[model samples]
Target: MARKPAAAYPFSSSPGSSSARPPQPNTNLNALRIPVTPERRPGAPSPSSATTTSAASSASRNPFLTPSPGTASASPSPAQAGRSTATNRPYGTASAANSSTHLMPPSAASSTASLVSSSGSSLRPQPTSGNTPRAALSAPPLNTSSKSATTAPPSISDKFSLSPDPSLWGGNLSLSDREADDYLHNPDPKRDRKNDRGGTMFTARGIVNLGCLFIMAAGLIALFAGYPIISFFTTTHQSTQGGYNLGGINQTGQVPEITGALGLIDVQTPAASKSHTGWMDQSTYDLVFSDEFNVEGRSFYPGDDPYWEAVNLHYWETNNLEWYDPSAITTTGGNLKIWLNKTENHDLNYMGGMMSTWNKFCFTGGYIEVSVSLPGDPTVWGLWPAIWTMGNLGRAGYGASLDGMWPYTYESCDVGTLANQTQNGGPPDALTTGDPDWNGALSFLPGQRLSACTCAGEDHPGPQDSSGNFVGRAAPEIDILEAQVYQSTRTGAVSQSVQMAPFNAYWQYTNTSNADFQIYNAEITEANGYLGGVYQQAASSVSITNQNCYSGHQSGETGCFAVYGFEYEPGDSGYITWINNGQPAWTVYAPALGPDANTGIAQRPIPTEPMYILANLGISENFGAIDYAELVFPVYLLIDYVRVYQKQGSTNIGCDPADHPTAQYIQNHIDAYSNWNLTTFDDFAAVSGSTWPKNKLIDTC
Candidate 1:
């Protein structure tokens, strides 16, 4: 491409060009130019002496008016001779005497014309007159010699014009043969490219360097300041509420201090208990009931304590060999004691004590705990001590009418049978009369017939004569801790289980006669029956020796005390968690508790009914054949305390229907049984009236 002439640029200094004045010589460019030293002749003054004198004289003069390099007097001075000699060489090889050559205006045609011709190419001189139009100068022909055979010489516009090319100064410029030879043999340190960068901080490269420095400083500040600002929002705050007061038992008592326990017992406070449970913030719970048994020689009989009653009845349900005598229960040394002694009572060879809060106190859902030392030693066999709870609808001693609440946690229906019963006008005669399968005779109450299909009514001792009579009460059992010797080799283990009979198989066992009990048990032990059946719920067990309990011995062993407890949430979406020695031993969901035996559909039967506590020490008859004479009696089950806590705003109380209202009960029944197995039943909305579904049984307010 043809290059534009110098006068054509907007910055050209030529007269009559209508352009801006030419730019000044860059200080960086001056630093890059190689100052040429003229070779000395025999009779002439040295170039250095002449250059020094001329430069000194020219210091006060206007640099723009300095004479052109070759425009000297006819008899030239020594300085002029040196400047001419330096300018005649290749471009960039100029002496200090001609340093001001670049400051000349373009109208100084002699200086501009000489600068182009000095590169071994001659140029036509431009007119100095303001009105005279200058002709465009063409670039010289490129040198074809072997020295520059491969590369063309830079054009005049590239060398002298104010172009951006770095070669406009001496840096990286192509040198002539003599200059190249001199640079190779006698290099000038001033011509080094590293020293070419000369500019004030306001220049382009200087501004970029400053920007990089600022960026590095900003990154360092961010790195050092980040952590503390993040920690300000994330650190945990200490709770303000103090530890829960356990009836001030820790202050003045002979009771041993509770240790390594969890929930409210471990921390002895609600706020701190949540840190161990990790289930929910327990600070939301309030202490509703507590029994420290601090009084010495206090009776646990019905009239003596408002919260507890000693069991005086013989417990025949499990065919236990021990009769629970109220005389065997007493308080002494700041502890409640239940003594197991060998005696003949109610045709049994042993006597122990069992205490309950059946009609006195109950709760719908909350935290319940008991700390007790079991009786006997680890080697003792047949010793069964348990801490458990049952629904308030059923009394502990009467197993006929009140026993209906023992296992049925949720209401279930035989939809096909109910549909038939509705068409046939009423309940079948087999359900009312003594059909062995539907209503069986109880061993405890021989003449009484209890129907497994119909649960106990809300009215004590009998079913309600109202329309909601068939809507049974929820009375599921939660076994918090039960220690038994299943194997003689392993005796320290304690089991925890949530038991429910949604299919009513437990009723069969309770109502069966002694002659046919084994036959009925065999049927329920099948795959489709009670044992491992679809209705079988989940259970878990852990050895007390493995847990961090007090004394680290078996349940029956002396000096062995463990924390046994459970937390219950009441609703279709609730759960029950069993805590053994302050740790969660097992967890069971509400939906997993009561599944329909026939269809395997989950009933979501978490116990919403109010339940009272029970603590018993009995000798179970189920332990395999062992000589009773080898076991020693007079062992003791010591109770440290029993405590209960309810949610802060809950209004639940013993045997109260406030928490599970009738309207909510109907809605829950509809949600669980509606369209179940593609078979819809009668609407439960009429439960308040006389139109309750014949097939479905639900909880009443």
Candidate 2:
């Protein structure tokens, strides 16, 4: 069916008159302008007078026009087919009917100036409250012979003939003073009546239009200012570690309150940590490991220091497709660069770089700091980069029992016992029942059993009281910062996890289940005294909105660059602290002491095993899953520097600071280690010789 068009409404008060009465001014003039017909007053004059005048004038001026209103009868007439008489009107309104008898001669529709001096009196509209007819206001007769009158069509000024002072409507309108004076000179009743009705209607229409305009403007502002504002406050420039905006989260997943200068590298912390002058950075220290990486030639690459060696062992561990490649290492811009390039070698499709000071240099405890830039954006899948360290006890010729072992193993400590006469030899202890082979058998060093299972029934053991309450323990495998860029696929955010080897019978266990770890991604789990994966207390994790990802596919901005640090000071009861930029994010009392000493006093022993420093860039799927296909090729892990500083006057070992292991080796046999630093080892030969200096029993490792 075809849709019908809506009926049109006549603006004039009467169709019989060619000249419309000027609209009258009223409080409801706006409402009357709407399509709805106004109800007729009870004592209103019949339309016969208007019809007769229009008909008579039409016939005299132009015979082709409709008949005059004077000829229309007040009584009913059967000859008028579709029209109804005044007594039998169908509609309640007098002006509702459309008929030929209701039109006037065209000459009567002239402008206001033409009608002013007419001989006959003209009709005007009455007030709204008046029961009289709307167009009953009588005006002076027009002078037909007036020469000044001209026949021009009426305009808006004639229809809206009322007071133009906008202040009458609460001083918010735009009417001018000149227009108000014109309204006062010409008292138009027709215009006044229409104004009275239309005032309310136009006001309503204006309010609706204004509301729509406001909404559109608000939406436009949000579109333009949204992202820039977010990027400004959340960008990495705000802090070298994590940017914590107002009511927003930091990289450590902490929602900080709005305080201090926003979008600046200022951190608000407790008075104690901020004022504590004993932090490693504040104390005087001697440079132990320093690789400016300013050397680049045929004789050197990135990890080519006399104290460093390239790890060449290849394995398909952690779903990683990359094999360790020595060629991927390079030194440029005064810093070490580990390249993760997509290259096919033999059956391998991807290659990465890894190097460490595993055996060359190891210290008991001190400060380890590194300024490194991660390989790729956190949104880039399969990009895993890390700067960390592992224990040196697993290396060849170490005094510890787990020394000279390829895959480090831990002995089961199902029954906690305290014993001396310890000797450092090979893997596993025979302290528990139902064990297989000599792997768990004791290796005696003539007097004492140096390495034995201490924590009973504990898989991941730490320093504990007699009742198994957690005390403290030194963490092996100190991960300064692990940048598993795509590690948050499961948790849905870019995260940093600080992993440390858990306390096992064999101090630095390499197994994942026995590793003591802390992640900012999610909740912290407590690994109790039950085989090195259980603990007494846990720090609950909370969800945080990750704003570290780029806004577009290739925005050319990674959104984050943080200075990460790990410090171990055994003198402070094995206290370990993780530093984000210069502010301390968290601190843990991780002593390398066991519960077997059975003493609540300070007599409990602390771990003196030396730990080596390492920094590598590799792909791993251990912490979180990865999609290798989604990665961008030719990624890089850029290191500004890796520095190791120790207390100036303190000595964990009796060796002089000038003749320490790393310094001594560099002074005498620097050529041996530095010459083959880039070579990939194809055989399982230990990088050791008899010429290497041997230290005391306590500092042997």
Candidate 3:
């Protein structure tokens, strides 16, 4: 690493320094130095010469350095004449034996700029008889290689360093070892003033030059300290509030700032609002669902588990090397650990864990927050851990629904025999004008869509036809956070995205060309339709909650946790606001369904169906290629807690009577099945013994 250069020596022009003004022949001339009197060049139309001559002629009663007609007539008082004695000639021209104090006229010392004329004119005037030649006053060529190192260009180290080395400056005399050490190390003005015998000697021009250099250095330091923050709020020229221009990704891959209504707005809360666990709380919202992962030393599996149900994916999705296993899920020390371990499972070399609340917990529009920390740095090859939710039309048991879609048959489920449950009801006909019912044999109810399936044969029925069991042909998929840091090296930039796939007509077209579906970096306006959304990315060093925490993890160690959330209000084209670090960062809304104003493509309205929360740690080849042997065994995705909140008195479609018969469902069916506690934000805080404040406003919109 390059070190900062030593401080430059304070520029104090003395007799020894060529840049110094000509030495005074006596104390009388010392008082004459206050006025800026540049020597007049003969026949030159210089303003400085006229000022100097006029000042001398008028101030003859005062001690003047120049010989003027006014001074010749005025005889100085006896005391003034006695004190006008001198020790040496101007510019040290006196001989050793005879120290005659002959003062050179002020016209000898011309402006430095004029001294170095393009034509080789002498800097000093010719000497009078019995005086030294003008050549004696001229400074010699700088000899950098000499022992004193007088007047050298700045060394390579000094030029590139944060500060300029003082010894290299031409006007400053070469300091001795003791002087250099004292000036560089003890920079206090008191010490400098003490060492300065003839008081401050900096000329006006020298002070101005020093001021300019200080300003430039300050600017550079400010830019270095604030680049991350400035970059986060800068967007491409095409980007605007509520609109994203994915014409191309920046070469730096920076995420653009969100603007307009889509930008973050501070929702003022009550004066005594609480801030517990570093989360600002508002009073208007209620805590409906939360999995604090307080259950210790046990895995949340079937029978007796209160919050989550483990699902075995059986190595049929994402071309992942791991099989989803219940054994890999564990709760310890107030945290949920989803371990990704390398092992032989169902003919797969790796096994991971996943859980969901498909039937147990589901809700419509509200806020969902997950506190999670992931494993591995941005370049950790292939690691895909996500906290997401899927819309649920089937499991909601809206009408004749049995835990919705095709879930693995569970004996405890109240939906009678698995085969006897209600079949696929198909897409909502009113959602569009003759919507294709895209799933065909797959259930029209929304659920997590895996890349593979194998539970049923080729020619199966409505819920589970042979086309590899079933497919999701339902509501949108909200990928709250998905990171692909594997694309960037540890010290390089890290990138992640927030994605939503509305299973509408536009989705059909975009999914066909999935490679170009991403929005990159901007806020999505309602004009983009429900099927599309804005994208965001950040440098690994900048903290962008949930994906990476810039402060916690440094070096190659990846141990980061942060809050990620979203709010959905079903009105005016269905508003959805994405949040990070408890701040509403961006928002997207449903667009006019069928034939957009700009693209003219038929789009689907944002699905009004409820969705169930799901958290999974899946190893996917889609993130990037990975080697099984290179995988870090026992890597885990640690979830501190998962929470969901909603505005009070909102319709509980997930538990409304029109949905299912509660009496036949789990005990305290609404609370048990949904894992939701209905209470005001403050009430919930009291119950949980937390001082954290809750949201007071209704919506970021």
Candidate 3 local lDDT, 1-701, one digit each (tens): 23222111122223334444433333321111111112223463433443334334434433433233445334333223212212212321222332111222233333222333343322222222322223223312111221432222333432343223232111223243255357587577876778786455487887998998999988887798667567767834532211111221211234434333112211222223212121223536565555666657666565334335676655342356678888889887667888887789888878988787554456666777777776554435567677776544333212222222222211111111112111243233213322245322212332222101213332111143354233222333455665444234333122222232222222322221113222223431111222221111110111233435422233643546667766766432554555555555544444422222222223333334456667777787755566455556677778877767767676343421232222232222233223223222234334444322111111121
After TM-score superposition, the amount by which residue 122's alpha carbon in candidate 2 deviates from its true location, in angstroms, is 99
Could you tell me which 10 consecutive residues in candidate 1 have the lowest summed lDDT?
441-450
Better of 1 and 2 by lDDT: 1
Off by over 4 Å in 2: 1-282, 296-304, 315-319, 395-475, 485-553, 557-561, 591-607, 651-701
lDDT of 2 by residue, 242-271 (tens): 111113332124443433422111232222
Alpha-carbon error at 441 in model 2, in Å? 19
Write down the RMSD of candidate 3 (Cα, Å): 30.9
- Give Cα distance to truth, residue 232, candidate 1, Å: 53
C-alpha RMSD by candidate, in order: 25.3, 27.0, 30.9
For each candidate in turn, the TM-score is 0.45, 0.38, 0.39
Displacement of the residue 104 alpha carbon in candidate 3, Å: 99
